[model samples]
Target chain A: MSGGGTASPRHVITGIGAVAPTGLTCADYWSAVLRGESGIRTLTRFDPSGYSATVAGEIPEYTASRYVPGRLLPQTDRMTRLALIAAEEALADAGADPSAMPPFACGAVTAASAGGFEFGQKELEALWSKGGKYVSAYQSFAWFYPVNTGQISIRHGLRGPGAAVVAEQAGGLDAIAKARRHIRSGTPLMVTGGVDGSLSPWSWLCLIRSGRMSASPDPEAAFLPFDRRAQGAVVGEGGALLVMEDAERARERGASHRYGEVAGYAATFDPRPGSGRPPGLRRAITMALADAGMAPADVDVVFADAYGVPALDAAEAEALAGVFGPRGVPVTAPKTMTGRLLAGSAPLDVATALLSIRDGVLPPTVHVASPAHEHLLDLVRDAPREQRVSSALVVSRGQGGFNSALVVRAAA
Target chain B: MAPFPTFTTKQLVDLLRECAGEDEAVDLDGDILDLAFTDLGYDSLALFNTVSRIERDYAVELPEDVVGEAGTPRQLLDLVNAGIAERV
Candidate 1:
């Protein structure tokens, strides 16, 4: 696959920040992942007694006041607050100050699925009961999906190519891909990732209506992806963002704490099963490999989407088999411990993939003692598997036929 | 008519401090007269809310243009004084 265009500059992951279900920081989250600890527990944001799924991956004991000032709290929702904190951490980790850099040279792109649903719900309650005048003026901006990108840009003074991706669960990967494009096209740096908290009754109800949520009340079994008992995924809340920069620029700045390089990425749509077309995940994986100038054998580990639905699981397994041949690759879905964070899911997976490359260890998929897929792929379970991970293939499938694949390679 | 209610510099500073929240970096002894609300660690929205509270408490309507033009505590105080004099 050749094209008549300037070769894009290599994009490297210089920093990582996360507010995940297991922990608030990337180190804590990675520690929990290595221990195979599950973040899924009984829902405390709201009463789930009457709901189908009573458990979810809720952030334990999160206090936004610790990160956001009181003056700005009313104007920010949980989603934006999480994004702001994660972006700050990522920038600090990269030793890059947006204020010190040319404002237009720095940019941001984020993914949001249910834009501030908790805040919007409050405004709607006020409108329905206390009348329109009682609704908050902040609602006008805080409840929008693009508000995450807007707030991050304003807070950091990043005037460069700012945007948001709303591709459902695949939006995280899409946002990273867009960030890579922006960097290659002249933007010096970008803060890109995804964060969402939809555990509120209104948000959870919306998720339940989609028929994808697991009805199990057991926390451990609620989101058993790729397991025979996999009913469906439990909705989780959290997000992770990364600071991506040009490889040469980072090295020139003497930045030593590098995670990995975003080698390649590709996206496709599944278009339902019976459109007389093949599954899109396999094509997306193949294209991503080609984009990275790599082969199937070059990939050391596969980060499965692990939707926790029977049909979707089978389809994903088949796609993996088609790419790497029968049981040709080691696969894992660490999201089993974090539930499915919707838009935040893929970004967190990307973060974990980078960490896997750094540590040369494949994080375990929690609570999968028996492999469910008949294809017999090597699934990492029980404990972290030690391996020389040079490249990782992270794949995600969204609700509305969105399939995305990203290849992250160990730092050069 | 009842004597127009007047605020001392200290009272005004206290009000600003209260409106800005305890966590804000509002300096009571610093150049409050020249410092912008943002410099005092209050965003534009917070300043608006503070202005609204001042109007309700003082029974005077601040001019609409004051929201954008009043960058300093001195400008805000002048606007309130003008409103008081006009009512008188």
Candidate 2:
């Protein structure tokens, strides 16, 4: 559906740069996801034999020196390094050089939850094992949640409207929404989306403690979102970054490749538990559809926020059913392959959704062969489905009652 | 006691290499004492880490301001050696 053509300048995705356990770049990631390759495995960063949620999706064949400068490596963390690579790829893909444009015409935004846990773990290890003096002074900001934005800005000379959001998984979508705001409010281009990770034992402890993580050792049985034997999430590292620019700006720069338009976005916080009010997931879905000036039928596919937990999964299913009828839309969770990337999850899903729009095929939800119980949803499983995906909805939720929904429709 | 020795350009360069990667253009073998850390491709964070290493290696306590104030290797040598001299 063409988003009201003349009302407001649309924010369109011009480029994608993503890294996950499955693939290192947007093209590779899309290929792996469509081919239904599983990247989930036992955690290898550090021995997790003693931990419950031992499985994770780690980026394959990634070498830091190859992607980031050696000087920046000492000052930055793994998350920041990954983000820098993604940002550089995105800039090149868009062909919109920041140094060539007015400083205020470009911006950067990113999201974080664990905030460089791998790096923090290293520093803390040095602190305890050795002494305080051994701690790198880079610890001051290397572990900071917003360091990705700051580092990206500095690296690319992006001097406009920098911001960072922290809402666990939902933050990815929120960060993209913020970038879209900057694009609408006169900024021509924004480096946005999230490349997040928390794969360290230190952050792993926190993730496992949340009781939302799977304790299963088997990769196939672990982190299943909707299946009967579904366990909790298998935490993963790395997400994705996207280059979103105003349609007119893209046209001017001759970077006319369009993934889709960020047509609508809405976020809601779930009321305090036991407050008697309903969960906000349903409301967020409804409002996002309304914001896009579309009805429930307008959406062709849904990228689910599939929390593998039984209760949360049920809630999300009910929300989808309330918006679309039972089995109304094709819903998939390609993340089942790479596990959930916390703050990185939604942006990865957003990138996958755009890819789905690009190639008329919907990626499958691996391992979840059948629903746990009779649910009013059509789960795409095992193999990718060939479909004409014009508009898609991406749903994401954070632990602290955060619910966010974004609508991206095929460019007119 | 003998006069407290100031850190040499070689020592600072060593610390700089440990803090960040070694830069090829910094002319480490020649005179680099007065060269600004920025010119040597050392950022504030690198300098801070270098200071931590220096404090440990020399058993000195540099002031908090040294990381920002010491732009050149010579400046860092003076501030850190001055702190060490006070103790000696």
TM-score of each: 0.89, 0.93
Interface RMSD computed for candidate 1 is what?
3.9
Local distance difference test, candidate 2: 0.86
What docking grade does candidate 2 earn?
medium
Q: For residues A383-407, write the lDDT of model 1, one tens digit per residue.
A: 9999889899999988989999998
Report the first chain's TM-score for all candidates: 0.97, 0.97
TM-score of structure candidate 2: 0.93
lDDT of 2 by residue, B1-88 (tens): 7766877778777777778766555566677778888888787777778888899999998897888899888889899878888868
TM-scores for chain B, in order? 0.80, 0.86
Model 1: number of clashes?
0
What's the residue-level lDDT of A17 in candidate 1? 88
Give the whole-model CA lDDT for all candidates, comma-separated. 0.84, 0.86
RMSD of each: 3.4, 2.8
